[model samples]
Target chain A: MSQTSRPRSRSGNLAAEKLTYAAMLTPALLLLAVFVFIPVALVIYGSLFDFGLTSRDWTFVGLGNYVEAFGDDVFWIALRNNLIIVIGSIVLQVGFGTLLAAVLDRGVRLGRTLMRTIIFAPMVISSVAVGLIWLIILDPNVGPLNAVVKGVGLTPPKLGWLGDPSISIWVVLGIAAWQYTGFMMVLILAGLQAVPKDIYQAAALDGATGLRAFWYITLPSIRNILIVAILITTVGGFKVFDLIFVTTGGGPANSTQVLGTYIYLQAFNIGEMGFANAISVVLLLIAVGLGWLQLKTSRKA
Target chain B: MKVLGTACVVSLAALAIGMPAVAADKATVKFWTLKNPGMAEFAAEAIEAFKEKRPDIEVVYEDFPNEAYKTAIQVALNGSEPPDAFYNWVGEDSARLVREGLVMDVSEYGTEPDGFQSILSDGWLSTLQYDGKQYGVPLEAVSKFFYYNTNFFAEHELKVPDSFDGLLQSCRDIRAIDEDIVPMPLGNSERWKLNHFITMLNERVVGHEAANPDYALEADDATLFTNPRYVEALQKVLDLQEAGCFQDAPNATSPELTRTMFATEASPMIYCGSWCAGIFNGEGFEDFKMFRMPEVKGGDGADGTNFLIVQGYQISAKSKYPEETVAWLSHLVSPEMAVRYAETMGRVPSNPASLDSSDQLTESFKWIAKDVSEITVPINVLDVKLENTVSEAYLDGGVELLNGTLTPEQVMEKVRETALKAKAKLDK
Candidate 1:
């Protein structure tokens, strides 16, 4: 009788534990299914058809839309611009952010909070606001930057900073870096602060001070945070829209066009929802690939 | 628990019973328009006037920013609660809506005794018609012109250019006055500004006979947009650039900034739409004057052929109050409202009969009104006239053309290639 009772209690506990797990996960899984999975599935499904946003009729085109995107000149230009933005952002935001974060961590002796706040101020401003501010500052005729450039006896870009196709994308990249670099600095700075002073002291005894200590101890300690900073920058870079939309509008002959704006142009402006969907599928695959890479990297870390 | 449940049911029942009665007394006509300066005020006036004319029909008004309005209008039309009557540009965009069956035929309603058709002509009606059916009530037209600073011309002792060649020489003369000055600061950053120039140039150089066919995509692919004069029209724009008519970086400049340049006397001339009259005035620069896009020597455009985009309102097919919405639109475009429209918005009203009666009209507004009345043919703007794909090519080409990155032949080559694709797609 005692052995039978013991088995019964154990079974009851197991059932309760399984119930707890299901109860915790159902709402989250339901939300993910509704918001993420279903939309992604629908997007992929829509890519196989030719349809307008308002048109009820859908013509199945198989892989025709994707093939069209591959052949599209504007599509290639937009994808190239996106890649430029991604790489430029990583180098400018992450590379400079590490420098600034290290300086704020130990180099600067005074106004630490003030410098941090000033550098990070742009991060708090909305991207649209940032774009508007930059637009005014970069105006060809009236912008002070041009005046300053001329005053310094140097000629500005002949087609204006944002007007020249050769240089406009780089200007946009610089503007993006300006907005995001400080945020990266703050993120890395927090990670640096978490690093113990004892490690630095030990490194100093080994004749590893300043740049050498930073290279050995300071960097190795914040390795995971820097990886995260880079990951965030890469994702944010691909997803960039409002800034480019507000500034160049993928213009000066589609020179500044990115994948996000191009997708919008096809879907809303051109009314080619299916083509837009195909582009969105490409973006989604890139995002998934990046996410998987991040996951693998985290596992290695 | 019983008392609370009973109270909740009673409240819901009261709401349900009251809603239909309220809806019965006043059928709502949701109206949408692009948000421009003074447009909201004009729309509010229209709504108020509509209430007086049709007391039973309540007009609900909504407006969106000009850039956002295009997307908003399309999205709203596809949504569950679409506007009953929304403002639309009269061209390919309006035609596409008709093709998609998103808008109503309104032919029968528009032809009724109190409809807009009674006051409007076949030409004005033709602007919004597809397949001989009127789909909209013409509100106003936006015409393009060269707004020259009167003081600048006066100070420099310059005559207003009358021919396209004269215009180029005029740019040279102005630049001669001040080599550092941008004779005409054309901000083509958005690309439409320069496209507007080329649209008028194409009409001037080749006329509607060659363009309309290619524009309509009825021209055979071999000859599609292959007109040598189409390149000549782009060449005319390039000629302007070479004469130093524009800034070194025209492609990067904003249209608004260009407008301000003329308004603030930073630039002496601007090829601007008639709407600039109000803006230049509002910016406290009233000593400016406008002229038609000067004649192109050896061109086919008639003496009075000019840029005029007929913008108006269309009733949604999904509207529950189509008849009432049509009435509301008709009232908005009536002679009395047209006068108020011209006075309030400083636009060229469709019906200018009552414009002289409105003593509130600006001298510039009256001048534009008289000039618009004398127009022989209104060439709809190319960006709005052409189908999306071709228009996009034109816009992008305009940017490249201004940037000096693409020559006239290259620009037209790209445009022709795009037109061929668009024509093929349309043929299918």
Candidate 2:
């Protein structure tokens, strides 16, 4: 064929290729609409109505749910509890996980795989089971922890760790930290391993050694992974329910009730579907906002 | 490429065609229940009975642990494929269901002349009623009664207290021997557990006497909580706590732990419900006897009264076969079924006529039945929102009061605040 005729043939091929790409994308777009977008839209829709357990008595009271939620003291308490969990998990999980990963990276020679498995074991177990296990371990009268405390001549420990309103949140936070730290450890370890050794050598050449070397070179290298870990941990912390539900039961007197459990109570217990949906909408907004901020900061870095 | 696309479409079509054939065949009835060992056995037998009666029907029983059962059942009901029939706790949970139209009105089944004898006690039937419609069959009766360690009482030469002061004196005498041995092991952890104590005390101390003549438990008036008798009754509970009559770390101790302590004779007195009769018997404790809690001194109508809580079955509104579901519920409350359930579960029957003065009845239960025939008002069934909000406040306030964090008045104030919020919600 002549060169001009060949060009026309290529153009036809390109057009056909574009049509194929569109055909391939259609299924995924349809799935997203069915599963993700539709449910989210429904949640937003439900938030505008007064749905309950038995009755479909939905009425459009504009922003009434949001107003009620803002006025409700329990919602504030739950929100505060969520904040505590988020901060606690970020500090204890990512912070400790990174430290542990760094220590392990320096080469502890004794059964490394076994130790890693042991640390990661809790993460693999279901959250409900983990909560139950901790509940027993923290039992005031029968738990071995109290027995050990007494054995050491401590005044017989009388604190109901999980049942006491003052201390239940801390116990719950500790359980969350315990189960998830290993997960963060694995993530941070992967990030640490990916850092080129040449950078460390360069740091050493500049008289930065040990702790200073880690602060200057190592942290910068794994900044993205840390940010990712924070993002994941933050969302996980905010959404925590199974562990708290099984362990403290949002007692003594709703002391440990977080936003997730509160939303559940409003929907199922009190049968305030509209109020629950409002809480969920707020949660979605918060999650998106925080996630966006994290991504933007990571991109800037 | 055109050939490939056609083949893919043909396979998808074939798979879609085959999907319905693999779908469930039998008329499936989704059933949800709290996981109880005895209840599990009872459920199995009932399922067998149901299947025998209707061979075409199939049941899918979903058992959840008791703690998560309430939330799970609620969530499931909200889902697309909700259960056809399910078990529900009595009081506000059932009331909310009935009010919301999630439960079927079983008045037709209950009010039938051929319905089970005493199929609905006036007391239990009241709980199932919302806006003058019945929703469930009474399955079990539970109430706070005084359970004493017979061995301890005998060893101490103590008789069952006839009056409220006498009961306090008994506690004092018991505490004189061992300070740690609380006469009543009131654990504040599960706040609802304390409600039993509070309700029982209300019956004795207030004796249903209202300062305002219009103060009625069932009335729609907002002045119910303002009764002086209610305040006095709550104060008495706080008094018991102040007297060191309850265990330390009341909120920390589980009901199981408290029962274990009583069973082991660590504590001499425990106020619990008739449902625990099975528990004590299962533990093979021979030295236990129950009695009606003593009346408060100088209270009107304080002669004898006992609080009653009932557990029952309800048909779901979404049931495909409403008639069949109602038939099963009617069978559940029949005299034959009631006797079998009571005998199996070690609980008293809701049917007054079923009490044939049988020797099988525990002595304490028999005595309470004979002397205290009046059924204390059920506070839990008054209003859905009110009950939950008040119960939660009662629990939290009880915990604080027991822990010396709040006074009786403060607790009452907090409860008032909670009640007002609930009332406002209901009004809206």
Candidate 3:
């Protein structure tokens, strides 16, 4: 085999190898065409029409759905809520995640595995379970949180945690932070452990140590992982549905409605498939544009 | 030995995998309903009697929870695996299925001798009709009212209020028993609970005939939801809230929890559906009585107008076994099954035949049946009555109304805006 891999023979096998590779890639390409590309094209096409899911008649309005979505106040509220969740998840989840990862990396030695496992346990649970658990905890009537608040001298919100319009979205954000911060921590922790220990040791020979070692050695080393973590958080924030669906259900006059839930409301609950597709297309474009911007900015950096 | 064992396993596995869904001679008819506790059992019993009548037909029963049932039925009807016949509320949901040509016109089947139409009254049969064509069988009607603990009412000397102001006063009188005693614990977290309240209130305040055009989305955009009485109906709900008729955090509490509250006698009153009678009885609390939502003062509604949500089954137009499906539905509304439904499910069956059987009707249900028969004007809940987007707005507006984030007028304004948008969309 080694003798057959001489330069002339290697050059001759290139076309055959290329053919084999094309044959191998055909299934994946077809799968992508069937699942991703075709559905996206259909969604974009459907967004231009006016139709119900069950109605046999489909009227082509040529961007009428997009027009309605833009003029719709609930659509704007949903977009604003999505942005709030993204920024807030990044700050609360990624920010605290970095700190926890750093502490677990070097500062804590005793029961390190135990602490990591405990901190990472919630990540194993589904978001729907997390939402239901927090729903009971934040419930105004029987939830322990309000009992504890009233036990002390403080007062809970008048309309309950998820019921109060002014604070329900923030409460949902906090719940998301609780459930997902552990995941971000584990991701960053993998990056931290991959940072060669000798680099920190060499830095310690100089003036860098403690918080300084973290700021320079740890953060800069895990920069790529941090970018990945932020990207994951942003995408999850935009697609958040189950938690908000189970908890607030975009209620108290839709103060907690995100784009995902609003799209579901338009599609399933209200039976406006075309209008829902328009909102979905808007979500898709925003996601693609932000992802492109992130990649470009990361590459520039 | 190993080869023989493998052959045995494969043959057994093949037998398990290729089992028939029903007897080879029987044609399967799919049935769907909401997942209430007793409904499945009652449906099974009915299917047993149906089997005795038609051994060649098999009924495959399925159910979904209330909210999911709506979406499930809609999507299922459009998909390849549509139900042979599915339970549905009798307003826009069923009518929309009719409009989309998804529901079968059982007019001929219904008009045959011993058909469901012959079994039920003209009014009961007409409730599920569209343009004089019968679309489905009317199984039952559920009405909402103030269900009070009989013992607590007697102890507190509380009378069932006949007027809206009197109801508020009743709330106050019950509150005097204890400040923390949620006089009537409303569970509006799903928003539909309050939607039911607003439905009757609107019926009482705006009158059904006047609000029908707006609800139907036939009124002009400029005049849609322009009735001042709509605001008054909202204010009535607020008035109940101010009177401490509900718990402090009604918008957060669930219907089940609040129903448990009333069942446990922690609360004396609950404005719940007629189905609560069965649930309360199942929970071992049977000392409960019912009364209609009181008429608002100076309102245009008639004396005996009440909330009557008619629900029934419609066959999918695309069902492969339409004859069997129609037979199954007809059997569902049969005299024996109607009695079973009333006895097991504690609802007012459209077919009142055989209700005189022993243990066929609970005392609480008998009152419901009498009131339903005597109802001068029947109004379905607004969520089922209104157009979809407008219904969504009404649901959200109800939550905001309870939250006090929006005043009654503001709530109506939001509803009016949504109605205008829905009307405009319809025109387009």
Best by DockQ: 1
lDDT of 1 by residue, A7-122 (tens): 89999999999999999999999999999999999999999998887676789999999999999988899989988998999999999999999999899989999999999999
Model 2: per-residue Cα lDDT over B349-398, one tens digit each: 56645765355666555544443346544422222224665666777777
**In candidate 2 chain B, where is summed lDDT lowest over 10 consecutive residues?**
B211-220
Lowest lDDT block of 10, candidate 2 chain A? A155-164
DockQ of 1: 0.77
- lDDT tens string, model 3, B1-428? 99999999999988876676435568999999999878889988888989888999989999899878878887888899899999988998898889999989988885566678778889998898889998988899989888888898887777878788999998999889888888898877788999999999999999998899999989877788998999999999989999989888888888888999999989988999988988898899999888888878899877788899999999999988887888888888888888888888888888876787747577888888888888987999999999998898889988988888889988889889888878887787
lDDT of 1 by residue, B116-215 (tens): 8898877788888888888888889989899999988998899999888989999999989889888888888888898899999999998987799999
Q: Write the per-residue lDDT of candidate 3 for residues A227-249, one digit (tens) a residue.
A: 87888889889999999999989
Q: Rank order by TM-score, top first?
A: 1, 3, 2
Q: Which residue pairs in candidate 2 have backbone atoms (N, alpha carbon, C) closer than 3 angstroms, thus clashing? A: B188-B250, B189-B251
Please tell me which model should have the higher DockQ, number 1 or number 2. Answer: 1
DockQ ranking from best candidate downward: 1, 3, 2
Q: Which ranges in model 1 have alpha carbons more than 4 Å from their true place?
A: A1-6, A299-301, B1-15, B110-112
TM-score of each: 0.97, 0.86, 0.93
